[model samples]
Target: MNISPNGINIDEALEALAACTVWYPDYREAMRIITKCINTTRHRKDPSSAMLIGPTGVGKTRLCRMIEKDLGPTQQARNSECDKKTWPCVYIELPESATIRNLSVVMAQVLGGKPTDNQSVVILEDFIIQRLVTIEAKLVILDDFHHVAEKGLTKTKSSLCNWIIKLLNRSGVAFLISGSSSAEETIDLVEELSDRFPYRAKLQPLPMADKASTSVLLGVLASLEKEMIKLGHLKEYAHLTDPTPYKAIYLATRGNFRRLSDLLHDSFEIALLRGDYTLKISDFAEAAADLAFCCCPNYFLMSHSQLNFALKFQTNKSSETAKK
Candidate 1:
């Protein structure tokens, strides 16, 4: 393990590593798709919507954040100075205080769009339309949609989803929805709304044969190493290598990028405290042992053979490519 003068270890500087690597090509593609959707809908007269379906921890939140980051400057400009009045994107997490009335209120606030609560649906609907028209929002991203169903906010969900569709049908604004796979089924229960999401992207786990994916995994660790270096801890550990941390990472996290990151990060800290500059199999072993006790069934039962197969698959592909 190499140590830096700052005593930084793998966990400090690259905390984002513990979340999701935006550098992954697959994840990047998802971001690209979202950006395209924003561009297409931004100028449209009616609203549009998109759905992102994936297992937990495959970077849905990260992708959403990336969209926000990219759109922030233009969104801010629109919010502050645009006479044409457009909302490039407005994001709301569905789990938070999402009653029908409150959700309407929040969306109204975000889009500079109005909520017409004149004690009449007609008045309320008109107010909302006026607000949306005033700002000209291109797309709205509703995240954590699973919470909408879980909270028993069926009417709220219906009203909100319907409102979004109405915006799309009548005003041409696009919506981007992101949630767990369960969310798709939940949304499907409301088929009318689900039909509106013509574009859907489901982020799959990193394929084991994808050197690009595995390499990105190491790239994340290397970033972590830089963090450790900042803490004057880089030299304190051994140079990380093959079967390196990835073995334990792949097994415990099941290629869920977020979970893999969390596992490595939490475990690395424990390993560092044990005073080893070089991370060994034992560092990961202890980490796995701890994870086993945390009630994650997959982590506890991950098969060594499964990991071996993945590694072998990667090796053969590399060899074949080299021969070619």
Candidate 2:
């Protein structure tokens, strides 16, 4: 078994590996758009909202969190002239069963307001608007915006979208909505709301069959390998840039970044358990089966035979283990 000469243990190494965040070109483009939206909204008379639509596991939430971190929290005033805090950006996730009142409550909380259940939606909305103005927030980021469609809240979703349009008109703050592709359905319900969010940015998974996309995916893998080595997570290069493991990962994750990361993390854990520091195509196959069975039951049975054929050199250890 190969081990790191840096003396980092397997557990610690795997932990570090899992915690690393890789920023690719698509994410950077999203960040650029977010920054531009914030700036435009801050200075313009008519505030514009942006929509970030992507499929599940494509790092939509991760991108929003990165923006929030970059903007940081509100800072309190030191001088006596103005004693209010100034929050440049506010971020919140819409509730699964989202309603106007609950959405108000969530926004109020983000703006440092304590909203009670007894408070009327009108009061909460007013309070949220005032707090947003008080803090002088330039941008508002709402994640999981697609949840408005869940539980058949069509009427409520329409009302909420209209309210958001009013909020932007009144508050002069840019609203950035991030959600899955289903979010488009919710937005399209309101014509005005759809028109207001004219700027749309989408994060797409790397295409498995596209040569350019494959090259970019391979580049990401190579960069991740370099990052792990730089962080002392590996004693030597994992050679993830090699065709064997690269193709195996692409097949397993279908070029989804989140799934690829999860697959790699699980494979690293397996390698650690087996006292093998090097990553191999077989490890990814095993990790895919393990992850699919544990978290995605829908894909487990169908993927077993495919995984076996993808890496024909190895016996179906993952399937055998699944039986046990």
Output the number of the TM-score-best candidate. 2
Residues 220-263, candidate 2: write the lDDT tens digits.
Answer: 78777775555454454447765555555666676787887787
Candidate 1 stretches with Cα past 4 Å from truth are 1-20, 73-87, 96-99, 109-129, 149-161, 186-195, 207-233, 236-241, 271-277, 286-324
TM-score of 1: 0.67
How many residue pairs clash in each candidate at the backbone level? 40, 0
**Estimated TM-score per prediction?**
0.67, 0.81
Best by lDDT: 2
Candidate-wise lDDT, in order = 0.61, 0.72
Quick one: RMSD of model 1?
A: 7.6
RMSD of each: 7.6, 6.7
